[model samples]
Target: MSDLPRLSSSRVPTPFIAFAVLAILSLALAGCDGQAQEEAKPERPVLTIKVHYAPQTPDRSFVGTIRPRIETDVGFRVPGKVAKRLVEVGQVVDVGQPLALLDDADLKLQAEQADAELRAANGVLAQAQAAENRAAELRRKGWSTDAQMDQAKAAAAEARGRVIRAERSVELTKNNLSYATLRADARGVVMATAAEPGQVVASGQGVVRIARVAEKEAVVAVPETLVARAQGGEAHVSLWSEPGKTYAAKLREFAPVADAATRTYLAKFSIPAADDAVKLGMTATLTLAEPASERVARVPLSAVFNQGHGPSVFVADAATGKVELRPVTVKSYETRDAVIADGVKDGENIVALGVHKLDTAQKVRVVSSLSF
Candidate 1:
């Protein structure tokens, strides 16, 4: 009763059995932990994002050319040989400036002869008048007949008429002589010269081409599809030769009918002032600003994906760090960009690159690079 029986040597101890149960439990727990870790891990994908931004203003682009506001073909009123050329090509000439001279020797001689004839006619008229007065006096004194006096008066009248005719002829001859010299009607630059010294030109023949130097204009032919974009307002113009230099112009007018051959409308813009650098036939580019509408977000054209039904973009939510496919409406499409009218908000991040390979409701790692 006082002493317990000795335990058998081959019997397992209680401490050892407790240790085996604990070891089995530990192995089971480790397997469960491994499964949970595998399930908790998320599939990460590489992606790029572009934030939606509000456009400061809308810009419209157009192709155009530069031209003079007033152009004319200069010619002489009378035909003659070109005796002298007064102005050279590209030379600026003022009003009343002599541009060219024609051979006028014959005209000058004709004018001188007409003047001499006029003087002779005047002398004959004076003599006839004196004789008519004497004949009237003789008729009153009964020395001459009334019919003879009347005839003398008729002769004097005829001589007076002849003198008037001769004076008019002299004036005509002088005018013809003056016509040989060609003069500029307005201040302009000589664009082209069709006649040279010693070349015979016909009346009204185009001898020189000139463009007015006071007012300059820009002429642009807009396609039918884009003609509606041009409005009567301010526009920015640039020259191809001069990069980064811009000039301000006002839209003057647009032709009502489109050109039959080109199917484009002609638009004219008035430059503020005459610039020496600006010349006729120079190429130019015009940029007109579009009217302001409701504020909307815009993104690059590459960021937009056309999914048959509509346009859409991938948006990454910052709160949950998740990417979701969202549909958007395109307000306008430009050369290299698109303006989103709806389906996105300001400051929202959008997937720009690697959007084609993404799935709906996927987690993405945003890169630091930004797109224009």
Candidate 2:
């Protein structure tokens, strides 16, 4: 009995040994499963993005020209020689300012002649009145015949008619004399001068060109595709000469029809009266604001992947954490971004960086440290 106990008694059961090995294997498997669960977590993708929301405004810019608000062609009212040009080109003038003078020597001579004729007519009228009174007195004293009194009355009536005609001639001459001086009807700057000293101008001939100095306008041509968006909106204006300064203007008018040659619509913007720095014919840039109702998907210019078939972008779904190849139609592109006309919405996130390696339906882990 003492030798048997020392000799390890009876041999252990094979099934029992097998069960012990199986228990150890189960414990090792459990530890491996715990490690796998931790390692299976996904890594996030790195991206930079701007949230898609209602666009604050789509500010579009276009080229334009500076033009005068009001342009006028100054002309003479009567025919005569231009004695002198009182204003020069680019001269600022006020209302009722004399712009030119016509020769009045002939007019003065005519006026003098009319005055002399009026005085002569007055003398004839006085003589006729005296003769008529004398004839009436003689008839009353029974010294003159009725036929003499009738003849004197006829002579007095003819002389009074002559005096009235002479007075009208004098008034007409005075009016013509006053018309010899050409004057401006409004405050403006002279843009052109067509008359000079000793130049003969006919009535209604343009002697100068003037434009209102206080009101300025910007004239721009909008593309036919964008004309509808430009009507009745405010515009931002920048002067070419003064690029740093900007001003606001209101869109006042747009042509109903498009220009035949250029296929663009003509539009005008009313701008504040700029100082002398803003000269006529200076170039300007106009920026028109688009309405907020137009919704569009946009992305950075770099995010777009160019393919022979069409343009596309990389989209990452948050739920699945997978990248997808999405086709997009580009509506328009600006300096740093592009506007997708279709095929996207406001809430979806897109891969902006490292998109070149992405494929459709590929699983990805979003790394928290790299997520933008």
Candidate 3:
């Protein structure tokens, strides 16, 4: 006992040891085999969807801004330094309301000069009339030669022409003086102010922006593909604040060319019955709900499986419990779905998910049905 090494097991025969090791290995392998068989036995479970009939609604919705049917830039008719801004931005103005004033010291001086010229012309004309009358009287009395009478007549005619010119000059000077005061030409709300007091502006350079409140228009940008439909389709406008109320709108105008950066066409729609709540610059939703361009089916994006054999979906046979990869014509791809224009009619079952691992001969147990 003192010289021998200790042992954990009793000394056994070689044949008995080999037999025990074999039996343990066989049991371990059998357990693994049983697990693998269990894992591979059941049919693959998949999610599917049954196609159903639905009346399509073609909606082309765009976010747009509410604008006025008539908006114009108001400016001075004559160039001058602005003396005073008579009205501020956001002020409601009526027709002929003075908006701003230009420095009119020079204009007044011009008017006075024109008046003086008119007076001088009138004096000369009066003198010429007196001379022409005397010359005619003398000719009638045979006391003046025809040559002298003709000369007097020519002088009177020239004086009369100068008077006419002076009168026109006076009228023009008066008009220029009145133009110094910029006035509103229509009833509107001032939206913007460009010129301030003491600023010089050229003739017809806008100093204020006014929007006429007679009618409201919804202005939106349409993509190139929907340009024609937006121009022809029935449009409805609703404010972001007031989602429940919608106003009927008609297409008033559309840009012939697309924007260079966005490739969108600007469109304007007239709202005939817009109330006071439809304010300028308010955000609105412009929906172009045209009749269904063509009846078609739309399915979830996951249902499509394109694996080098073109785009297809695994269509399931409910009676046979098997699936087949059927080709489909995809019209368009949306954010969450694809529009199917030519394939997969109503009342057909198709695999909605897990199409990557499915084969035509393999049977799939339907776990759930999804709605598109």
Candidate 4:
């Protein structure tokens, strides 16, 4: 009977042991489940992108030339033959500098003839005065009639008027002779000469072209696509001779019509109070900062994952350190950047590369950040 009690007690202990073993097995299975779940969730190092809405800068490398604002064509004021070309092309001239002379032989002859006429007129006036004085004395002596005295007075007055007219003719001849010489009307550089020595030129005929150096400007031919941007944005100029230096420029004017030969718009930019370094015909380059057509954010191409649905990017939340798939509208694409129109906000971080293999609830460690 004592052995039976002991066997029964042993059997009871076996049930407790079995219960403990079951409890241990359940705890082990729970631990394995927790480990599997942790393994299933991926934690990969990913490259990230931050949303940005920066105004794009337009590239302006158009070739240009420095030119004077006023290019005047100067010519002679009198009709005559060019006796001499005093100034050559590229020669600087001051106002009233003699440029050329006409043949003065005929002018001299006309002056001489005027002088001879004046001398003859004076002699006639003296004879008329002597006759008038003699006639007045005869009238006083009662031997000369009133009609004869009056006629002598009229002749004297006519002779005196002729003398005055002759003097005026002499003055006019002197002025005509002075007009034979062509002179510069303004201070400027002679760009071109049209008349040569001994060439007959009429009045107001263009003999030389003068470029006024008072104000300078940069002239460039802009492509049709860039004309609007050129006018709207700020323009800068740099001379090829002094590549390191730069000059600020303003949009002065633009040609209304396109150039037929070049098929480009001619734009002129004025340099305010430019120094002497900027010379006429100097080669230069023009740069402009253009505004974007639409304000948008830019992202990398690798960050986008379409998968038949609209394009989406995996954006990482800074607070949670977790990634969320965000739906974005791409405005346009570049070689390395994608212009996002509506999907992302500025300053938001996004996955830059390897977006296709990512899960919606995946936790990621940002290895590096990229700016696009």
Maximum-TM-score candidate: 3
Q: Give each model's whole-structure lDDT.
A: 0.82, 0.82, 0.88, 0.86
Which residue pairs show backbone clashes in model 2?
43-365, 43-366, 43-367, 44-365, 44-366, 44-367, 45-366
Any idea what lDDT model 3 has? 0.88
Q: Estimate each model's TM-score.
A: 0.60, 0.55, 0.62, 0.52
What 10-residue stretch in candidate 4 is worst by lDDT? 2-11
Give the least accurate 10-residue stretch of model 2, judged by summed lDDT.
363-372
Question: Residue-wise lDDT of candidate 2 within 244-343, one digit each (tens)?
Answer: 8888888788898889999998998888847777777899999887655566666788778777868887777666777767788888888987888776
**Winner of 2 and 3 under TM-score:** 3
User: How would you encode candidate 1's per-residue C-alpha lDDT over 1-372 as one tens digit per residue?
Assistant: 659776675687889989999999999999999999977756454444555554346666777778888889989898889999989999999999999999999888999999999999999999999999999899989999889998999999999999999999999998999888899999998999999999999999999999997888889887876665576434788888785888888878889999999998889988886477777778888887655546666687877877686899888765565877789888898887788878876667787766677777566666553544
Error of 1 at 19 (Å): 34
Better of 1 and 3 by lDDT: 3
**Winner of 3 and 4 under TM-score:** 3
RMSD of 1: 9.3
Candidate 3 lDDT for residue 62: 93
Candidate 1 backbone collisions, by pair: none
Deviation of model 2 at 188, angstroms = 2.3
